[model samples]
Target chain A: MNAVLHLAAASRVHGEGATEVHALRGVTFRAHPGELVAVMGPSGSGKSTLLTLAGGLDAPTAGSVWIEGTDLATLDHAGRARMRRTSVGYVFQDFNLIPALTAAENVALPRELDGEKGKVARRLALTALEEVGIPDLADRFPDEMSGGQQQRVAIARAIVGERRLILADEPTGALDTDTGEEILRLLRARCDAGAAGVMVTHEARHAAWADRVVFLRDGVVVDETGADEPEALLVEESGR
Target chain B: MSIRQAMLAILEQGPMYGYQLRAEFEQRTGETWPLNIGQVYTTLTRLERDGMVEVVESAAEDGSDRTHVSYRATESGRSEVSEWFATPVPRTQPPRDELAIKLAIAVTLPGVDVATIIQRQRSATMTSLQDYTRLKRTGRAANPEAPEDLAWSLVLDSLVFDAEAEVRWLDHCEARLRRAAADRPAASAHATPTATPETSDGVAR
Candidate 1:
């Protein structure tokens, strides 16, 4: 079981001297292929910092982040950018779809930016859109679609190339409960099909969708759970 | 939680023997709440005493004294069933939640580390929550179109929602405790007797 995303004692500190802030401290985390891991914490607990470090959007002040066997710190700016486009996909709370682009074009932008042919990128985007259950909405612009639809487009973009790692930060924050569950279902299905996913969420109900949960607090890893088989409910009724 | 009301509700459809009523109950509740034969019979007797059901007794086999019996809901019982459905279950008397009580007690005790209590419970509840979700995923894919799926899933949904709420509450409790610890001045250390009331005021967070 190779981990698609791995952080070894990762620490992220902002500034120094009297005004320093430690967003994360000595936190080792991993998300393996075919698994979805949820990161949960309070507002200042570094959940977002951990996600950015794992996705290579930010560097750790100490330790290292490895995505699909490549160390993020070892890669230069161009190298990290290339890694992000090729292997890592990010889903934000706001959906992050470009209003100017249609759903297909939005999904295809990632593939096109990575230097694939326009026709080929669009084809790939169409396939990803189909996987997210919105193939018919490929031509719909962000404003023309509902929040859930836009999120589907965002997820299609994330998984466009069968990207090996998916990073979602509060991915369902903008949607209603049923729609959020639908998005979670899509994320779960993608992970089940073999991508590693790390999602940062404050809602425990949303975290319930993940295969495992990592709890952070005060810039450190506080606890971890959900890897083992789920135990029986307390006071389950006996005898029928 | 009321076997008596549940049995009456099932009997409203038609007359049913004790075992049959139990089967119907288990089938509808996704087999989560199992009832022993004795419980069914006991509840049936109570329902009969309350004028909610009527018993039809017959001699068993070869002229034996012991009898076989079936139960049918009386008109009153049918009305009760409808009333139960139409009215919301009252929350005035919630079952004792031992975890909540334990944490509440632990927070007030001297030398108690409330954060550890919350963390351990949160971990356990999250695992349970995950299990419920796994059950839901497998259950959904296994029988997506079955009519029984809704009943089963609704049961699982209750469990998932409860566990999630517990975890969130635990998180809330920890945050409140942390805020209390931060707000109390070092001077409060010397005035430990008066600090309890002030700490209780930290409940807002």
Candidate 2:
């Protein structure tokens, strides 16, 4: 099977010499198109670092990162940025929206920054907002919207460019249970729309929404289980 | 500790209200452990039902007032705790966390879009890290001199450790994605090696 994204012997470190901390220790994984994979780990397990490196947001100290048949490390900074803008969509836990901008404007920013025509970007942005079930809220500013609404807008922005890869880091962290679930449903909807999504979350319930869950510990993939497991592992642990 | 053992341990210390039980458990364990109030009460009620513990006295029954119910461990409860203490801890099987499996399958699944997912996860993780850091800072600032400060510090350490680890993992995932993308054509070619059909006429299938 063709991997849409692949990591080979990837490692990331901070600082140098004795002060250096190896956040990712020769870690490797892959994700294909149309897959919704959840990365689960306790604090300091390097899950987010893997996501960012996969998304071309950062460079690895060793090994390579591939997205859509291209080595991101081989790309020039501008080239990497272009690929990310055109192919990758990101949804953050706190819904990283410009509070001053209307939802439509926020969704359009990526395309607009990529130098698309204003009208074309806005039209696509509106379509993306509709995809996330928040078309009516397009005119509302981030501050005016609820947490779920803001997240929907974030999702809208993420999919507006028709990016094939969508990464969400704890997309529901700030929301209440119901609201978080709603955000997760939106992410699922995005996958249904043919965009593969990856989410990093501590909440097992949130991870349960994904088609698969990857467990990490101390910067390594420790275990994995299908989403169809009879009960969430965390719940089972609590039960024990 | 098992739920029954935990209840017995709490009662052995002295009578405690439901909320008090929850707080004390969390405090004693440095909040590395989590117990919902419902879980505590449910366990306590179960102990009472099993005759392992009994309510010595009920302070009040009014709905609006704080009702304090004091419970003491029975002889059986004491025996249970003793057995619990004497028993060696059971080694649990390693968790088969669903997320890791999903990620592994996602990486190899035909036509799956792995990079986008990582990007989305990176954003979400960063946001969570920020929130956790803020909460940790606020907690430390609010209780600089509290006796439970050490416990709070431990929680903060855990939060920081998780957030930092997640961020690092996301980076590693991205790098591997880039490499896989670069190697796709060659890998795919290697995966589809030609094979001869073993029929009457050995023709390539």
Candidate 3:
């Protein structure tokens, strides 16, 4: 499969001089089409930094990030914003849906903002909601729905249209066990359906849903292994 | 499950020979715990001796049928099975967890990187948790409503929950260590400046 998201030696540093903190350091990562790559690390380990950079929400201090063969560094601010809207879908730990909007409306907002007609965007939103197994919930507001339902809506919003790259950060943080499993199943299904996905999660069980796992520590890629070889991760970590 | 009870329980349904009992037990429990035929027969012999089960027949004189012996649960065995079902599994005496013991020792031992041990164990547990979830998914997909399938799924969920709890406990341990370390300097300043004897009451990080 072609690489849908790529970060070549990407680095992100916050502040300058004595206050400077390196969030990511020369981390080269990639998520290919139909693959879900999970990033696992402790707090301050730059898992979120890598996700934000991959989603084009943050720029790398050095190196480059490419989505679908297009380097993010090459895009202007307006172009990058358009790219985020049209190609990259992001799911935060919080649902991040506007309370005033119903599930369908929240999902449709992105497409509508991308200049798609309201009717077309709504139709696409309903389809995406159906894809996430909650078409009936499209009319429910965020407060009216359960956390799991809201997250399904969040996923619906992320996956609406032809957005081929989905980035999720602790998407199951607030969910119960069964609900979390359901969310992982949805994300896994999306990847199986051909969207490249990168998720930042502190829990290893959450990372297990990915096809592969990337371990980050102290702002660098510490280890990378297939999901089946998780024990190998510890072996590799011991070497470090 | 105890082998003696399992045998008696299978016989509770009806009279079954040793091999038949073994097959039925394996079938009902989804074969997650394989019981050897020899163990089944041995348990049955003990059950019969204990009056929990009685052998109905050894064999007929006919040359064609001489190898099989049937057994049925006696009143005592029926009561035993019922009691087993009534009582919950004991939790007062918890099973020893190797990871827990290892962590306990690692925390007290000097020069051991307890953090690394916890992290490694967390990774291993997470792998097991993932394997359980995947098994559950595949098992359900193959046999959605089978009682056997549900039993195995419940078993897998138990493993997942246990592993998750271990990871959480490991994180808690690390956090507690950090907090204790952070409080040490403040704690030292409050101690008497003179050559006071060390107190065993001082909290160990």
TM-score of chain A of 3: 0.94
Q: Flag regions of model 1 displaced more than 4 Å.
A: A233-240, B57-68, B140-148, B187-205
The candidate 2 chain B region of ten consecutive residues with least summed lDDT is: B193-202
Error of 1 at A166 (Å): 0.3
TM-score per model over all chains: 0.89, 0.53, 0.82
B53-114: candidate 1 lDDT, tens digit per residue: 99888666688798878888899999999998898988999989999899778767777666
Q: Which residue pairs collide in model 1, if any?
A: none
Off by over 4 Å in 3: A203-205, A223-225, A229-240, B27-32, B57-67, B141-143, B177-205
True contacts recovered per prediction:
0.62, 0.00, 0.13
Tell me which of candidates 1 and 2 scores higher on lDDT.
1
- TM-score preference between candidates 1 and 3, better one: 1
Error of 2 at B83 (Å): 36
Predict model 3's lDDT versus the native. Answer: 0.79
Question: Candidate 1's residue-wise lDDT over A85-169, tens digit each?
Answer: 9899889999999999999999999899989999999999999999999999999999999999999999999999989999999
Model 2 CAPRI quality: incorrect
Give the candidate number with the greatest lDDT.
Answer: 1
i-RMSD of model 1 (Å, 1 decimal): 6.4
How does residue B161 of candidate 3 score in lDDT? Answer: 73
Model 2 per-residue lDDT at A228: 43
Task: Give one digit per residue, the lDDT tens place, for model 2 in B62-134.
Answer: 7556557877888998999999999888668645755567768877776565654654565555445444433
